[model samples]
Target: MAKSPMDTLQLSYIQIAIAFLLFAQAKSTTEHTSTPQPNDTNTACIASERSALLAFRAGLSDPANLLSSWKGDDCCGWKGVYCSNRTGHVVKLDLQGSGYTIDSDSRKVLAGNISSSLLGLQHLRYLDLSFNEFDKMQIPEFIGSLHKLRYLDLSMSMFIGRIPPQLGNLSNLQYLDLRSSYQDRDIHDGTYSTDIMWLSRLTSLEHLDMTYVDLSAIVHWLPVVNMLPTLKFLFLTSCQLRTSPESLQLSNLTSLETLFLVGNQFHQRSTPNWFWDLTSLKYLDISYNGFYGPFPDEIGNMTSMVELHLSANSLVGMMPSNMKNLCNLEVLYSYTSNINGSITELLHR
Candidate 1:
């Protein structure tokens, strides 16, 4: 049994077979571990969109290098750029100057032209260029083409000339801020709107701030504003407006919470009676308007009023007895006015 050559040969064959099988298994394991897998890095931005952003960057004078991260191929990873996860579409471009200092000689404001190349971002939903300096350039009519935009803030951005009616094309716009400086209202170099009939088309508008934009030319502005049923915050401060709330036959602003009409030239003899219908209004600032007459007893109807500012008006007489109905009143300012009211009684109520 110890000297059997056939048995030894068979044993050697078995060992060789097992060795080959082990080597094959090791090779398979090595191949499985070393194989390249799909890249899991965040989706890269589309090449065309990235090129559009680069073109947009080329137009702006970014003195603060605020756009330094914009160099890479993936614009989705760039500063102030946001992309949709599913489609990798650039959905937001927020280059607001508030993130930088504007008071110093080394102002961080981005100056220069806003390129129309931004139109390439067809899926962009939010765009903010507030607090930047544009050298009194007129807002580009091309911005209206960005129909997907839901938020647009261009406040204090030094944009001049007539507001383009093309903005009405933004049917999906929910928040719009075009607040400029009152000093910016020059006959030749101010942001003025001769025809704001386009505003009525923004039926989805919820918050609108057009402070200091000269709207004095639009005589029938009230009715157009009344068409917006979803408006929550309406700030038209110092707009040189002449339209009185009384002109509105029926107000549809049931959702209005904050209404700022300060520094306007409404010149009404009395507070408009239509104001009482804003029962849902939480903050109302109608100060500095040339309103001269007795304070309306309708103040009692504003039960939801939280802050009421009637400063610098010509309203006279004691507070209305019904003012006690404003149980939620938090702040009341009637300074520089002839409104003599017992504050203790009004507050205790």
Candidate 2:
């Protein structure tokens, strides 16, 4: 009375199904057990960031209520302190315009200075210290150590020192604003160098603002910016650029949309032929310079232009007849220039 082959096969199938179910259950249990519970990385990183902030606060004579709630017990909830939810790493620390007072009697405001402790923010990405007073402090070279930094704003901070070439090490940097910090008197020491060739290493930079920084000696440095193919918004107002290069070409910066060169000294020269080739340019300002020459007939090539400012220059020529081709142009400023052209046609369009 041997069991049929079909019955034996059925028994084996049931055994195999049970074994498979048990193995799946065991795997699920292991995964549940091995999953890492929330730990100290987040806590430690937050603490470190807070500690850096506290050090900065202590260094200041007065913090002007900007750091009122920056206590250690509940640092994660501190204002202007942003931490990663999962990893707890501090990523953003914005302390702009803190308005700290120096002395009780004199009540002189102590503008924020660059604290070396801020370099400890290993994961910091966005830092805005603009509109504060750095009191003639030099930008700390340690800032170059922030490998993960992407956006930095030190504009209007009153910092007086040579631009740190080490900033080129920030390969991930995308936005940089250092405008209006240095005054005309700051140039007496001749510390400013036109050797900004290190800026080419910041290939990721898209928006750059270096207005009013006394760049008269660095006319050659202007062309070097073309190396950054990713540059989109460029502001170089009042930089004392004395001339436009004959071979000035920026066709590679196809993504450029906004360009500001107001109050630069162009030495009364012909507009560079390459200027018409920027097909992506939307906003352009070249006002208050010495650009003297005929407007290029190919000016219409920049059909994407929406706003164009060329006022207060010594340009002498008939306006290009092709100017009517700029259908997208909304605002055009040619005042104070020797531009001769009938405006009736442009007004009609």
Per-model TM against the reference? 0.85, 0.80
Alpha-carbon shift of residue 138 in model 2 (angstroms): 1.3
Where model 1 places Cα greater than 4 Å from the true spot, the runs are: 1-41, 99-102, 182-184
Candidate 1: residue 31 lDDT (0-100): 29
Give a tens-digit lDDT track for model 2, residues 1-349.
3446786566446433533343334334432432223333345445666788778767764445666777755455676666666677777766666333354543323364567887768887777776676777766678888888877777777777677888889888777777765547357422254678878999988778787776766757756788888887787777777766565543568888777777777765655645556789987777677677886676678899987777656767788877788889877766657777786776578
**Where is model 1 poorest over a 10-residue stretch in terms of lDDT?**
31-40
- Candidate 2 lDDT for residue 47: 63
List runs of model 2 lying over 4 Å from the truth: 1-45, 98-112, 183-191
Extract clashing residue pairs from model 2.
268-290
- Candidate 2 lDDT score relative to the true structure: 0.68
